[model samples]
Target chain A: MLQIKNLKATIDGKEILKGINLEVKAGEVHAIMGPNGSGKSTLASVLSGKPGYEVTGGEVIFEGKNLLDFSPEDRAREGIFLAFQYPVEIPGVSTTNFMKTSLNEIRKYRGLEPISSVEFLKLMKAKAKLVELDMAMTSRAVNVGFSGGEKKRNEIFQLAMMEPKLSVLDETDSGLDIDALRIVSEGVNKVRNSKNAFVVITHYQRLLNYIVPDYVHVLSDGQIVTSGGKELAYKLEEMGYDWVTNND
Target chain B: MAELKDKIIEKYTSTENLNNGEPVEIKHIRDKAKEYFRTFGFPNRKMEDWKFFDSKPIITNDFKLVTEKQEIEKSVLNNFLIQDLKANLIVLINGEYSKENSQIITERKNLFIGSLKEGMKTKPYILGKYFAKYADYNADGFTALNTAFAPDGAFIYIPKGNLLKDPVIILNILDSRKSKVLGQPRNIIIAEANSDVHIIEEYYSIGENDVFSNVVTEIHTDENANVQYYKIQNEEANAFHVGTTQVFQERNSIFTSITLSWGGSVTRNNLNSYMNSEGIECNFKGLYFLTGKQHVDNHTLADHANPNCNSNELYKGILADESNGVFNGKIMVRQDAQKTNAYQMNKNILLSDTASINSKPQLEIFADDVKCSHGATTGQIDKEQLFYLKARGIGEKEGKKLLIFAFANEIIEDIEVPELKEYLVNRLNEKLEKL
Candidate 1:
């Protein structure tokens, strides 16, 4: 459902993603493992159409359409969601209000009627329970005083609310503890379906134990240099990337 | 130095005369005002308050005199109407009261609303002593100039031992048609002992011509009386507005004033509150939201002249684009004003890199048993918050707009009036939609 070829990107005159190629089909979970400064986060940023990123050479196709031509909002409307590594603390903006506006904006772009208040509340309550988010947190300012784990859970809560076809989790398991990691992984697993996909990008193989991926790819520098089955994650955890990249 | 002073005095004399035809009253206070204006005719960059926003533009621009009366159309005046405010509406076009446009409903025996000229001619002794008594004319040059030309102003009075349930709204509409206009719309609100009332003064202009609105509102709160005053200045972007509201509270009285300035190229609001009696309380709150190349300056002073007086001041502003905003708040406690509780806070947000804010909160206390504190904060939107919203399938435009709206909602939440609050929020969202 998604294709990337020669995806080269730079930010502030510094080359990030030199050249990359990846493909993900429907109903499949792809885990992109890379070291620090390996352009994994840069790839997620470019896919989400963030500003200040210079896409020098790249062809990104989503659902058979060129995805690079759309604005950030338009990209979101077309079912592309990014679970931020660092959730923002927007003071005075209620969580429900922010999520409602985003959902309605995407729905409007898709030529759908705005969701009724009753339906929106029902959806919020159901998805909030999936991530174990407090109702009080939903009414407060978006992540203003939330803990690290609460913020990560809030991100997953929003992901379940939007229900995008392609979800990019950019280091969602980095700062999470064992309990939080389990809860976040379970939340992601509950939302997975045949019609949707997820790209879990992380530096460690521990998160894969909770939410097993169908395919494991080793991303060195920029491109994915190695691809294997789900067992590849455990093998890499035992033998680091240096062991694999030295022979490549 | 003498040449600059003479030039300042000559600027007013060389201008076309508007008072030559009419024979108005020359009271002692007005005579003092004339002398003050002649001595310090026009303010220059030398003055601290007039340094940032000089009044020389109003002096250089050829403004139409009060004698040049033009017939304003009803359609044109509709733009100046705040149709949502449920109060007695009085519309003043170019400093002149328009009875045809004013609506007085259910007037009580204690309330009276009419022109200042009529009040001066009919109630001479009452107007003579009380008029210009509250304002510190010699302290500011524009205040002196406004007092010098006190014609075409409003006079509102509430008698003793009566509580007025309804509010009185005065709409000051400056018709800046064709030429740039200069209008000095003065107002005097007097509340006797045991009286209660609410007054709102709104400033609006017609067309986009360069205009200057210099207004001064003097309020007196007697014993056991209460007055709620709201000054709203939403003039056009090309307009220059300077307003001074002086309030004096007697024993066991209360005065609450809120100044909201969202328009005008350069707007300055100076509010001075004097608690002259024991157990008197005053609250001064202001919110200014500026965009484009607009500039808004708010300077306030709360003087505790007696013991057991309390004053609280909270002023906030949100600056966008290349605009500049300022807030200078001063709180004073005299030696006799023991057990005085005063607090002042001014916060601002710069929405753009080019936007700027200058804030100064001062406290001068001579009383030992007083509780006073002042705080100021200026900042931009949190970057992590912006990224968080964008990641939730929200676009950049909607994200920025939401952040700005959230930033200003802190001040809007203080507005008690439900309809006015909703109207302001909707209007603000409309402005944010364009960005």
Candidate 2:
């Protein structure tokens, strides 16, 4: 589903992702674990085509197309979703309206008719139930004055709404408690299917217990030093990242 | 400068028969206003109050003062009124109220709605008590001009303890199809004790020729009365408008004013409210969206005279192309006005680098026990907000339009009238699309 060949990225003359390479097939969930300042978030940002990041000498291919040539919005229309580490608060824009606009825009790019109001409401209700989001929260401004757990849940709600082909969860478990983590992971697990893929990035192994990944990659000093299975996360959690970084 | 003044004087002298049976008090006020205008001529950039707003383009043109009312077709008048609005409609053609175009509910005994001229002839005693009382002619050149040439406008009076069921919409239409004209519509609204009323005033020009509309509205609210006033200016691009709204609030009265400026080449609004007694509340909100070479200036003042009064002010502006905007808001708390709470905020978004805004929020407090705060901010649309929207598959243009609409929606949502709020929202969307 996605391929990153010798991904070399930099910001302000400082290299962040140093020749990182990764590959993912359809229906597989990958977890990229690292300590602080290990360039995990940079990989997600580069995949999402954020501005001010210079791709020094690498290429990213998504679904048989060169992703680097597309703009951020075009990449979104092409089914690339990046759940932000910190969700933006857009005042005066209701979450319902925001989702409607985004869904319609993506549909328009794919030559689909706009959804009817009645159908849109039904869809909203069905998807919101998956994440346990309050109906009142959808009518209020998007993420304005929302709690940290609510924002994270809202991100999952959007993921359910968009149904993107490739979803990158960047530090989605940062500020969540145990209950919130369970609910959020349940939302992600429910939306998983054979046609999609997920790149879960986290600093800890707690989120993996709920939405278990097929493969685990330990990122250290801007490179993926080790790759293993689900048990590797528990091993790293018990011993710590130094077990791999010290030997490397 | 002298040529425009000479033209006004000539027109005033030639139209003597227009006010043949005017009351003696009214004639005296007119003469005094004329004298004041002659002494000061037109306000210049040299004056501190008129520094940012230059009056050169407005006063340089040789505009003929409209003395006779222009005939307008009923179909043309219906286009300006809100469709399906169940409110009393008062239409003014060329600054003169058209009785044939107005609809007033006579079943309400305490309600009085008619032309100002008719009100002067029928109830001159009541008109004389509040006319030119709140708007000081000596303070503003435009106020003096409107007073001297004031002939006819809308007059709304509600007796004590009467709550109006329907809103009153006053539509002022300027027909400059024949010549370059000047229309001054002077309005007075009086709400008796314990009464409630809502008013919506709008300006519309029918022609593409140069038209100057100078309007003054004075509102007097008695004890415990509630009033909501809205002023909407969406005239032709060749039009110029200078509007002054002065409100006086008695003990425990509540007053709210919303000013929306969407069109016109040069627009200036002076909105002032005076809280005379304790426990009074006042709110002043404004929104302006300008493009092309348009210029809009807003000056607002909230004067707290007694203890335990509160006032809030918020004004937002969106400037694109080469448009220019200015916002100057002042809140004053007198020495005896202890426990007064006042807040003022002004925000502007500039779309193009050539677009400019001058925002100034001032607070003057003589009472040490008062709580007062003021803020002014001017900047371009936030890049992060824009990118957030764009990253969701929305285009740059649509993203910008959405953000700008959201910025202005904060004030638009506060409108008490549902229909008017919806109307302004549509108008704002249409304005933002052209940008």
- TM values, all candidates: 0.84, 0.98
Best by lDDT: 2
The residue-by-residue lDDT of candidate 1 on A1-248, one tens digit each, is: 99998999999988888888889999999999988877889999999888889899979999998999987778778888998888777888998999998898888888899899999999999999988888778999988888889899998999999999999999999899999999999999999999999999999999999889999988887778888988999989999988667756
Q: Which stretches of candidate 2 lie over 4 Å from their true place?
A: B14-17
For model 1, what TM-score is found for chain B? 0.91
Candidate 2 chain A, which ten residues in sequence have the lowest lDDT sum?
A44-53
lDDT tens digits, residues B1-435, model 1?
Answer: 234235434655554343332233444555567679887667777878766765655666656545365556888777665557676776777777777887877477746777776666656656666777889888777788787775677888888987876678888888877676778878888999999887888888876677788888899999989898888888888788888899989999989888888888888888998888899989998888888998888989999999998898888888889999888889999999999999999988788899998898999999999999999999877666676666666777888889888877876676666666786787678777765
Which candidate wins on DockQ? Answer: 2
CAPRI-style class, candidate 1: acceptable
List clashing residue pairs in candidate 2: none
- Candidate 1 docks with a DockQ of 0.45
Best-fitting candidate, scored by TM-score: 2
lDDT values of the candidates?
0.83, 0.89
Query: What RMSD value applies to candidate 1?
Result: 4.6
Task: Output the worst ten-in-a-row residue range by lDDT, candidate 2 chain B.
Answer: B13-22
Q: What is the TM-score of chain A alone in each candidate?
A: 0.98, 0.98
